[model samples]
Target: MVISRRGLLQAGIGWLPWRAMPRLTMQLDWHLNAQFAGLCVAESLGYYRRAGLVVNLKAAEPAMDVVQTVVAQPQTLGCAEESLILTAQSEGIDIVAIAAMLQASPLALMSLPQQSLTHPRQLIGKRIGVHSDGRKAVELVLYSHNIDPQQLDLVDIPYDKKYQRLSQGEFDAVQCYALDEPIEFAQRSGQVPTVLPLKDYGFDAYSQVIFAPTSLVMDQPQNIQHFLSATFAGWRWAIEHPSTTANLLVEQYVEPDYQNIAYQQASLEILADYVLPKDAPRLGIIDARRWHESAKQLQQAGLIAALPPMAMSVNDNLWP
Candidate 1:
């Protein structure tokens, strides 16, 4: 059957005889792009169907709060950075991270060549545009460099239009996906930007961390297990076949600013570095140490009321 958005949303790819399988939905935290290559490949290639699941991929809308969006429908798993997930859990949300696709979050600060922003310390005296949601993460980068948050000028910028503003000289820098934005920013504006990934600093946290309601984890363990196994397998395949997965992403799940196939491939290759880093234990494996470290940092930054329990933040046993 032809897998259109109609079919994928209304039903599964090959769901006629498998109609009774567990139906699930994933609420993405941002627009669909190569960043979600694994899930895109998994859904388009019917990996979910083969694993007895009917999954719908929901692309994020502007101002969409992924945590509350999924919480409203507990059956829907959400993909977001672990920092936001930790904040939610600290505030009494019952979400548990099941798997981390990105061992290092690609969030970073980008600057024009003239600014010559070579290191985190260079950000101290300049005005950087930051979204409200990313303020904490950016602050952590500053603090890690022994620089005070107030030492730099951080003006709130719209996430969608940051590149436009940055290119227009509205600010010295903007928070962006180091892998995704620098490509398009360079292509469109014709000026290569300096991308400083947060991980290059001490702000280590997992991204694309998939989490579900803790109750859902306890209730539908098998269904969750099937989803994770197939999803990670899809990731391994995507990492190995970056070009193929990039094609799928460009064709099926492309965003307005991310239409170029070459750009998508570049983004996917950069994503592979984060997903399967040299020292990574394995793709899609959540590290207990990272979760703990992220939670503590979030607490220290006053982003969360207190550090949430490890069990509440991650389900380390569901990696199979």
Candidate 2:
């Protein structure tokens, strides 16, 4: 009697199966920002192929809700700020941060030099034009200086119009990234925006964390390892050869503007300083104390209902 396909599979139960392997598609949050440029570089440079992953680095649009997207597509791994992941976790989302692209936060408050607002306390009673989602940065700065959020008047400002609003005296300061608006403002307008870095103000949250559902981590730990290893190697190469990396970004990832190339290169160097500390063992190692401290501050500021226990938030296994 001829054995049916199912019977043949059962007959050779101890042998290897011939099922087709499933393809994985990871959905990251954004495009070629300084933090994500390394990922793009890795893809273009074939580092992911070397690591046995077929990564498709798609750009996330502004309207896309990453958390919802990740939840909807079980096969896709999502990446974004660690705080966002923490917030999702607090709300019972099953996502976990796998690796950090930036060991330190890059968020900052940018102001005109003429404003001369050197301290956080100086922000009190000022009309601050911050992106609506910048409450965290504002709260962190206020808490660091023992100022109440109620003291400052927060006006919602669109990011594209921030420079114009500040120039027109519509707002005293704007929440921005050290790499983007500050560099653009300085280059185009010859006005150096003073940056009050979040780290210096006791808000040491990690930025650009690699995240995926907890189920994915449990089922495919090797895939996570391979993705991070290649990604980190790409970062190492970018940090060491910023000019070449910037050129790659301009040619492959962005419009070929000479000024944009210069801006991106300088921004990448600054980001490198933040990603790999001089004394740190590896590039993406999370500082637990800093993580806890940031959570505590966020808790005190009433940002989240309660801080998740430290154990659930950070993974020490990510270290090289």
Candidate 3:
């Protein structure tokens, strides 16, 4: 999962150390890649430093849950999937969303060309591999298409082996992010796989959101606001200079797999669509419309028992 899982953003947020030079830890649910290029660029360009903050970029393992991490450490700002936020709320965990980087979620299903699975309805009787955390979304996608999830054969699989399983003909399709897996699969197998993005089938949710414990939002509103502004500024600059940003990412933070400047560039270019749409006024602006809609979608998916308190879940006041 790319917690940078999408949000095209990351690398910045609120909560500064009160003394002379402020410092904060930004827990990224996923590892370093182009998904967080905007954030990495902010540090690369010293945006956070100029704002009087030292942002520590921490990467997470596949099993590290950002929700619980933030809950355990209230002082840090964490990047996470929005659905997890709603799920946390259902479980009595209160986290406030300050801003979202990936406005349109990149969650998708990928299949080999031979399978030719392009639509949700095509999955009937097919064996599809699902990421452990992605089951609810898969179910919601099927429900949105007016198909019963029981009609398909769903298998739980590990993230690292999903694509390989698909290639071996063990499965027809596998859950993936629209931008991440597709490019990776193509580069690895030398073939373009068919993709079905969940947003197209009615399972749209925010992908990359900066979240903090309840007390942090209430206690440090001004610091959070300033951190968000710096983050948004970094996103703006990254969006405007995709090539330079990609290069910087490869030179600095990106891991070995994403060290390819071309690959990082491709990811950043595709993420442009998710980070900020054509008509978006600015980067990192969280809206209530998508917020409520996503909550409803989660309920329909049976991922959450009841809708979380919408008014308190997102920190809209953080924006200017």
**CA lDDT, every prediction?**
0.80, 0.70, 0.78
Best by lDDT: 1
Q: For each candidate, what TM-score against the reference?
A: 0.90, 0.85, 0.89
After aligning candidate 3 to the native by TM-score, how far in Å is the CA of 240 from where it should be? 1.0
Model 2 spans with C-alpha error above 4 angstroms: 1-26, 255-259, 309-320
Cα lDDT for residue 173, model 2? 86
Q: RMSD, each candidate, Å?
A: 6.1, 7.8, 5.6
Question: Which residue pairs show collisions in model 1?
Answer: none
Evaluated against the true structure, the overall lDDT of model 1 is: 0.80
RMSD of 2: 7.8
What root-mean-square deviation over C-alphas does model 1 reach?
Answer: 6.1
Model 1: lowest-lDDT 10 consecutive positions: 1-10
Off by over 4 Å in 1: 1-16, 311-320
Candidate 3, backbone clash total: 3
Whole-model lDDT, model 3? 0.78
Q: Model 2, 1-320: lDDT tens per residue?
A: 11233432333222122233233566766555565777877888977776666777766766566777887886677777666766777677887766677877777788899996667888899988776445666776787788988899887666666788887888888888775668878886789888877667777677877777878777776666656666787888888889888878887876333437788888888888777878666766655566677677777777777776452332343324
In candidate 1 the C-alpha lDDT for residue 193 amounts to 93
